[model samples]
Target: MTRLRLLDATRHGALHLDRARGGARRRLVPLGRGEIAFAAADMPLCFAKDAQTGRFELVALLALAGENNLFTSPAGYHATYQPRAAGLGALRLDPAGADGLAVDEADASLGGAGDALFTDGSAARWQAELRAVVDDVVAGRALAEVYARRGLLRPLRITLTMVEGDGQVLDGLYVVADAALAELPDADIVAMHRADELAPAAILTASLAQVERLRQLHNARYPQQIATIGLAVAD
Candidate 1:
């Protein structure tokens, strides 16, 4: 059971977050634009819609090859790079709203010993770091909204086929397809560049290569249920 409560110094001053178990089993963690360049090198960045707003947002696949997280294991959580969302543990903060920070006391990570959450009637140092991550997420989404308005996004069609027969197609996800970027007029490209979006778009296009890496890792790790992944660009 989850016991979510507003973070009050009197209530949670002594509570700390356990880093190791914070984002342990999370399969899809949101990535901010600021983390893109770094994360692209470590994991595949994908786009999925927010369930509530139905607007596109960026997510990092904790496990690319399998439904289970590749970043975590029986031994322990071992991701090459940690997403900012992982640092939150059971904490939830609204980037758009003022003054409502809550934490799930139910989370194992939020327990007696870890890192102090509150110091002197206010959020501790870690909250500042996480708040910055939240701001980056908000800023990144603003840029993504611009990308959608400019028609830079296309369906990132992922085909899942069995070794012997037909399989399913996952097309709800979207991407900044390379071809779509190419189709943009030089003027538009220049404008995007001037707006500081050209680089991230390129990064998103380049990140698709990681999909095959995920498949290879998946095939190597789980031989019993192997998957063949494929991508297609829409015309």
Candidate 2:
């Protein structure tokens, strides 16, 4: 009789839970579609609900534990209540499971990674354009600004460190692509970066064309691996 609830920071919403069974006849609750926050591949979660009050509670049991004492369950659930002394915070659910949870307080302070992006007045126009590009990538459509918004679009920014010229030092660059562009590959990404080029920071303002190109490059270079791009929006 276990139920679950999902508090997703990405979509900034809640989701209904689905029921399931894990090992040992334990009941499990799955989150709904698009219910995750940032990265789905590394953040699995689970929860149980009180039959009477109907308030869903996060389950603290760890399906997988690491040497560092970090624990991981399925997606949509969090282990925040666990003690910080245990070093278990380093444990992550599947990246695909990152939905339905807020960025942990510890993670929020690490600006380059694990942070969400915000936008303000000065960057509003660029933000709108980036959002359209993201929408197209998520929808599996081609990129055309014909239906794009004229002004003030809010898009997320994802940054990553790459060895650009000689692999001497890591160059941190921002990719102002749609949030959905996280799965794209590097070569194709290279092209998109060229197109959606942002000034001062060289962040790529990705569009559908850029996503497609990145996908092709990704397939050619690293076929089996998935890439995660960090996101930060303007305030």
TM-score of 2: 0.17
All models: lDDT? 0.72, 0.27
Tell me the TM-score of each prediction against the true structure: 0.81, 0.17
Tens-digit lDDT track of model 2 for 1-235: 2222222334322321111111112222222212222112223222233468543322222221111112223332233232111121211222232321222223212133221232221222323433443343333111212112111122333333232311111111112234434444667556655754212112113221222232233333432422433335443
| Model 1 bad stretches (over 4 Å) | 1-3, 8-14, 64-68, 94-100, 112-114, 119-122, 162-168, 216-224
Q: Hey, what RMSD does candidate 1 come out at?
A: 3.5
Return the number of clashes found in candidate 1. Answer: 0
- Which structure among the candidates has the greatest TM-score? 1
Off by over 4 Å in 2: 1-30, 33-47, 50-62, 65-105, 108-110, 114-116, 121-235
